[model samples]
Target: MSDSASVDIAGLAPAVKAALLEVLIHGELPRAEIARRLNLSRASLTRITRTLVDAGLLAEGGTRLMAQTGRPSEMLILQPQARHVLGIKLTGDVLYATVTDLSATAVASRELRLPSPDPADVVAEIAGVAREFSAEYPDIVAVGIAIAGRVRQDRAGAVVEVSAFLDWTDVPLGAMVTEATGLPCSVENDVRALTVTEHWFGAGTGLDDMALITVGVGIGCGLVVNGRLVEGAHARAGQLSHLIVDDAGPYCDLGHRGCATSMLVNSAIVGAYRVAGVDYEGVVAAARAGDAVARAIFADAGRALGVLVASVANLTDPQKIVLTGDGIAVVELAGDAMRAEIARRLDTEAVDVDIDVRLWDFSEWARAGAGLAIRDMLS
Candidate 1:
């Protein structure tokens, strides 16, 4: 185990830990700024920061000149490389992994295609990856695994209540991985894990309220409210992909007609073309070439997504909404229609909210797992 893995963070006072985290999140800040942001008096801030500096968790960096006086104040900065963590995203047939520093910056990554989704098989594969990363970066303290499912976790450990894609249920995923790799493991819902990454280090940074909507083989959402990821009672909070957008649209596997899953997912779009006797590639090519039929199909999907986005905005009133996933290309193709529908559906209060569109790959999700590891270590 690394020194960080054995460090006694519990020895620090809670207020001191909070102060250290504030600096970790916002980067180097003057002592006065830290005190103000943390709502602490100068004496309190000094005590907390000094303890963190003594613990080697924080470093006093370059001084900043005060505007009111000619005096300078030293800035408190977090030591990003103080510890490293591993994050793994387990899909149906692939495990994407990344090694990140305390700041959640990926310094190394790898992918392994699973031969099967059996619990033991996946566990062995995860152990292999952990060993590889451990050999290269002995500083890695713990591992985070993100799976697409209903994850249940408590003081005992984490279990996958259900993994719809992998057809898993009631599996002790955290225990399995930990035993296999000889390291602590944290398992989380993939979307929720991804949300944690965003809340801590990605686009959702500095915003207390934001939503991430992913479009792909399945529609997924992650929500952060009041500066915390909302993992509901059963840890299945943001399941909006099945929200019905059109009553007459295609039926989802869950049996919802015209739900976001039925209209916006890649499988749904490709299935629509198959039903219409058109090749999938031909449909995308035609859509790009302005074919009326292909364009209409994408436009309809976009409109459904627009309704979904607007509904989320009205309900949560988040500061920002991120649109991303493997199927986001469809949204870009039909951007005009989607924007129009969003404008029409949004309440006056939500009309001006920022909706950022980003294209993402599996590596980002892996990084989310790493972010969760960091959070687990700190917490």
Candidate 2:
């Protein structure tokens, strides 16, 4: 495999980059189809593909029969192994890491305990992991860090504006990691990073509009509108946690009663069950085993989730809604109530949206970071 660092993706012309991205996301496609999708003339498409193929960023595979015509055309595919990136997901107490190729497919992963919440210490640990991965995967070209907080990116690089879990604010995390590891680096909100991965290579592929809702210790959302990820002015475009669902619901830390966070989060589910020493998974198991109280709690949470989904659909009308994270099992346990609530809120006959439930692990989040790195390189 060629070293991605030597390719200089940012130096590619806009049309060539778009052509590469087109093949990267949609897999192999005939040159005619690529030209049709990108609205490029045959000559322009040929030049773009030639440039990418010369760079080893794309390759021509076996021929495919074109539907529009009876002739066969060469299939263009991404050289996925041409580039590798290190992705890291940071939580309060642990770090998840992965090495992914150009397509954001995780090839290897590891987990490490955070020795401290201190920013300096965290940076050191991330550098250590970057070094280890670089030694094993010499093609790794960049690093992407995903955290649960607000992030701001400018020419100066990315900064963690606020992270409750890490208790950090205005930290130049991207530059710090770059300086520490001698590699290009970028930072993004964990949920938003995951949305990028989904949009390009996972569940939301080929969709111009979508929403990803994550249920766990908290309720987080990521939105894509008009083929672009909505990063609000403050980088909090999809902040749906505090949206009120039930006036009589529980209270979040900000004292919002009956909010999405208060009703649908893992803690809320466990608290609603009023069970001592039981975790969210335990409660889910009980519900599955025919425990009435547990089932009722899940039902309530599901209803809240339905309300949340309805609100997103009502506002953005996304083509699909992706439900994921560690707490996604609640969807299976209380699917009936959730679907009913959605039906009650939306015009079922007029609106058709696909809801995809994905049981993702921490390593998936790490791969999201790699996706961000790939995006940054291209941009």
Candidate 3:
């Protein structure tokens, strides 16, 4: 991250290349503005922009008026179709995969119903998907996979450990991937990968610090700080789903009670409604219908979630908080209660960051994995 060292032509530079790349990928930045933000020089910036443009890496555009002088600025935009990356999200029963060119634009995607939970079987099937995707696109050179557990990392931030939710532990996922797909592979935690994708190109883009909370059959949290995803002590720091919010909360196999997932997940909400003797069309419908039991269930879930969000904001003071997942439907069920509790405990002044809670496509999760691979290749 220092300037004196030489930058690898293959890897993105710390400042100049990174700044330009961000503008291109995210779109619409002026030359003067890019120079000011990245502490760059206009002449040097033009040279870089020209090179990127000539290489079909960035698209250069017109100028915007600034003050009295209509200072001309080179606008940088991504050549999304220049390169390609492939990603897959592995679940117990199925896998969703996509191939994205350099700009993080999805070119082709696949959804495969898997055979067994055996890691080897899953890996082979995934390799076949990659092979097919690559054969179609021909520009793909990197592959990534997103799993749902801790990825062991060393002190230097090298990822060395992973145990996907399928009960596979200490697996050499990245290595196996490269060997099978014959491309550089980067394995990431599904949530963290999703967070990275969001931070750079999705909802969380242009924000320095943020959190993405996901709700589904399971609950997951991904944290980003100072433009880097935090992979604490073996990449398991953001495990807020297991945090106990209820002393008498329901049982979790992970040995915690009253956790966010235990009380707020899809299964939990459905189970709560079932216990109350109501059939369901999702938690959102149940709550909208004024089912007191459903309302109570979601409210409880919201309260617990509020506590979790408060903990993150209180601890990190990130610029924004993004709530997303396969189960925003449930959050919609008790939106008022969840927002109320979040407002109650959230430090409005100390944590001045805005909260952006929105629903996203499920495939975005898999694409995030591809984004990580693209990030790795670009770096």
* The best candidate in terms of TM-score: 2
Off by over 4 Å in 1: 1-13, 41-44, 54-56, 67-71, 275-285
Q: Please give each candidate's TM-score.
A: 0.91, 0.95, 0.86
What lDDT does candidate 1 reach at residue 190? Answer: 83
Q: Order the candidate numbers by lDDT, best to worst.
A: 2, 1, 3
Question: Looking at model 1, which ten-residue stretch has the lowest summed lDDT?
Answer: 2-11
lDDT of 1 by residue, 1-379 (tens): 5444456553557788778778778888788888777799988888888778766678989999978557798888898877788999998899999999988999999998998999999999989988888787877778999988888885667999999878999999899888888778999988888888887888887899999988877888898889888878866788888888899998998888888888888877787766566655567778898878778889989998888888888889999998887778777789888888889988876557688888777798899899998787667
**What would the TM-score be for candidate 2 when compared with the true structure?**
0.95
Model 2: CA > 4 A from native: 1-5, 347-349
Collision count for each candidate, in order: 0, 0, 1
Pitting candidate 1 against candidate 2, the one with the higher TM-score is 2
lDDT of 3 by residue, 6-100 (tens): 22323544554676566745577777777777777877777777666655566777776655347656566766676678888877778999888
The alpha-carbon root-mean-square deviation between model 2 and the true structure, to one decimal in Å, is 1.8
Candidate No. with top lDDT: 2
**Once superposed on the true structure, which residue ranges of model 3 sit more than 4 Å away at CA?**
1-16, 41-43, 65-70, 153-164, 275-284, 351-353
Candidate 2, residues 179-250, lDDT tens digits: the string is 999889989999999998899889999999999999988888999999999998867798888989889988
